[model samples]
Target: MKPLALTFLSASIIALTACGGGDDNAENLTTEQVLSLARNTNSANQNYPDSATNELLMKTPEAVTYYLGDGVLRWSTETQIPLYFVSIDGANPPQTLIDGVAQLESRLGDIFTDFKLLTWDVQQYRDTNASDENMGNDTFDKAFFMAQNNLSEGGMILSIDSGYYDKQYSNNAQNMCANSSIAPFSGALQILWDKTGYTYSKENLIWTNMGNNHGCKWNTQTVMHELAHGMGMYQHFEPQFGSWSDGAFDVLATLYHNAPGTKWADLQVSTL
Candidate 1:
């Protein structure tokens, strides 16, 4: 593995502090400064640090319950869902990827009624029409696969691969940490993970290597994030008074970072 990049670590800290609301100095910043900071922390950059603090936050009873409750975004009708992990063009999804899904399922499950993961196994789909240079084909192929299978209940098709496409796969300039179809309620949802740097697998698909420290363990969070989008949680582009102040820590942001006090359940009305 390459030596932990200190520059990446610094960049993540700057981005998170600017929008995560963890910094005490955030209150002193001007609106212009905050907007500028928000723009900087946009989805384009997926290298945000996943610190230990974030993990602790997720483990808290309130945080787990928040996601398990009816408030968080999800397919309202389907409580038990099957998430299919796909490997495009013969690309193999590591065991860590499956482990990440299992971890997510465990996190959302409880003694009482809770979110259940029906399928965690990876299914291979060969996109013969896909080109190494064109990422759009991957998107098309994923949709094609979903259509062929008639996936309607709930869940998402998550593809993990190392493609020869640019980091920016969509109109947004975001790195290919992951992207989804943003289907909510009763539509097809797909998520793609570009394993170009092997960054995700190295961190077991959960955490990022920030020097000697573990940055954001977004593998599970990324799964939940994409699933949340599929469930109808829209990205917060502007600063909301009671909700997120920026795109960095939107409804899904609270899941990835250490924000225990945020009333995420109250942010959006539950479709359930």
Candidate 2:
């Protein structure tokens, strides 16, 4: 349920802001800049100075809703792409990734609806190692499932393709593009690189090493990030809009959240 003429309306509104208006939210582009007045924490970077109360920033404007869930994107409408999530093993629940999906559907019913989850109570989905050679094939399997269900070209699926999303999957929609025919949003999809090991995960959060040193705890964040790409972020190349170290939230990073010590504000459902 996409908004009515949302593209045209937003474009005109953005043009007005360029000419100047009451766009206060447009002022601070960096998280550090966001909390310039608040006393901050030892930053992940000198310039970023990670703040306790800092509003987590993103790489894309669409990411705002992506990372923050449907509740946080200020201008989000009642329309959204109905996503069919592929809950693989590594990115499962009680760990935040899978739990976050249900939460989003439960809370942000306006933008997302029609929730269906695959319960692998017996045989857990494969949690591929970070270096699996068949990573691409695994993603293709999920794509095949969607195809079997007759998922329309416009529908979306969370493809835990290989750790790197540089390959094309033919008619499958992934959130790896900056203006890509697929997702196009900068921060749309996360090609997880085991934040623990600091390298790309062949499973891309689709598999878990039982909480050893696998990936970031924010699995759901990655899901929404890619969803934003499908929603049309169109760009993730802004040098100044990623980390406060990089600068501020842009279309790319906006797909995820950065709030500290709290997942509440990050997972609320009203904004999606």
Candidate 3:
């Protein structure tokens, strides 16, 4: 709600320009310079005034399939970390999103040493009831029901498709959503990101297309950003940089303003 925070959101969510070969000028810029662009909306700061803003830019909405009934496909690693993969209308998550999470976990190393994660394909499951039209917006309600029906305790669900993703959620931006709630009793965390739009709901996890080259170069950072929220890193940290007029800031601001780097790996779970 702060001016700087809104500026961060505006630059992160709405204003973005795709670069040639998806590289932009990032190849030549340092980490600090990129962070500068994310903080400033003025075109003067960037060579490619039309360049995409921090993190992944959102794609436009298109027709997508969905699974009918509410159910979840669960999987885990050799260590037994519960990982659930969501599907809608027979459409499962893209390998890129799941793989990205793996990559992030590996990068975290000791941070999530106790947490090993992995997901299986819906094709391997026989009980899945695929259908379109059943899953829509109001994802919060659906997540509550899914948690009661699937997960006896409560957890998170990642969706590759199905939800209420439009300009309203995106604030007319192009990126999708990755919303979550810190409260456990409120059902489970719902995430939504797909091919059409990238809007995430707080109750249930729903998403569409995800993979390498989908958008942005900070896939690992984006994954970590959402997951950290799951661990209750919901509030933003405003570290002083310049004058008070400089505006708002948060500890996780880098997730939106910069690409994946050592700074992320440097994060301590206790700090969250």
Candidate 4:
């Protein structure tokens, strides 16, 4: 979400391990079978949305996306996961974050295709803190972002290169709001560069961190990952959703769930 369009965070650090919880041989099955299950997104007919409602749908993210192997985005009423972002690095609007949002917007059509992403500015709570001169040039207030965004208990916020750890703000990113749950969305975080730059993680984001070579596809992954979070799949391809490890099948996987040499991951989960 910061100015730098290309990003580098960590994803491989948390190698997702599959337990015997879902299927015993599910892991050992041929790539084809796995691909099929992952692509499924319940292709049931969605009632024609009213023109007014459809106009609004054009603004929000989708449960499934065309770029995500042809799955439509879906959400259940009971589950409302909100993600907020705090920009502290003087980055009013993160270009990289914008690119990611746009990539998804492209595939889903002009409706939600080009919706304006969420963003807002806020200041630290403590009046003295906000006005303090010696608090260093690295002052940040996560609580303000939360309150501005109406963050709830389970709500999440994305860090658009807020320079969180530049000083004491590291803890701020760790805890977006007071007692609120927050997670970082980043990619492969190399140590040396991070020391000179910023730390990144793949858990919170889905973008590929190829250093100087991040854009388009890199941003695409971010869109997929963030949107998945918007849905209900919080973890990366967890086995809890029976035969749902396939990214295309599960809202979480998306682009990262593809095979090494394949152009686009197979998202035909039990094709309807």
List, residue by residue over 51-145, the lDDT tens digit for candidate 3.
33322133312212221111111111122233445543434445555654565454433222222222323222211232211112222343454
Q: After superposition, how far is residue 21 of candidate 4 from its true place, in Å?
A: 29
Task: Write model 2 residue lDDT over 108-227, tens digit each, in one string.
Answer: 344544443432221222234533211222333434444555554233434332122222321222222111111211112333222222222222212211111123122444443323
Where does candidate 1 have its weakest 10-residue lDDT segment? 204-213
Predicted candidate 1 versus true structure: per-residue lDDT over 42-151, tens digit per residue: 22224333454366345532221111112222222223444544433334445545554564344444211222222321222223354322233224342444455554
Q: How does model 2 fare in lDDT?
A: 0.27
Taking all chains together, the TM-score of candidate 1 against the true structure is: 0.34
Candidate 3 Cα outliers beyond 4 Å, as residue runs: 1-81, 89-92, 109-144, 147-149, 162-171, 181-220, 236-272
Residue 135 lDDT in candidate 2: 23
Q: How close is every model to the real structure, measured as TM-score?
A: 0.34, 0.33, 0.35, 0.31
lDDT, residue 84, model 2: 43
Superposed by TM-score, candidate 4 places the C-alpha of residue 233 at a distance from the truth, in angstroms, of 3.9
Question: Per-residue alpha-carbon lDDT of model 4 for 1-272, expressed as tens digits?
Answer: 52121121112322211101122122333446445433432211123234434443354222111112233222212222233444444343356555654554344322222222335432231123433111213233335544554543223344432211211232222211111012232211211111111111112222111111111122334333434433323234434232222333333333223321132243432311
The TM-score measured for candidate 4 stands at 0.31
Ranking by lDDT: 1, 4, 3, 2
lDDT of each: 0.29, 0.27, 0.28, 0.29
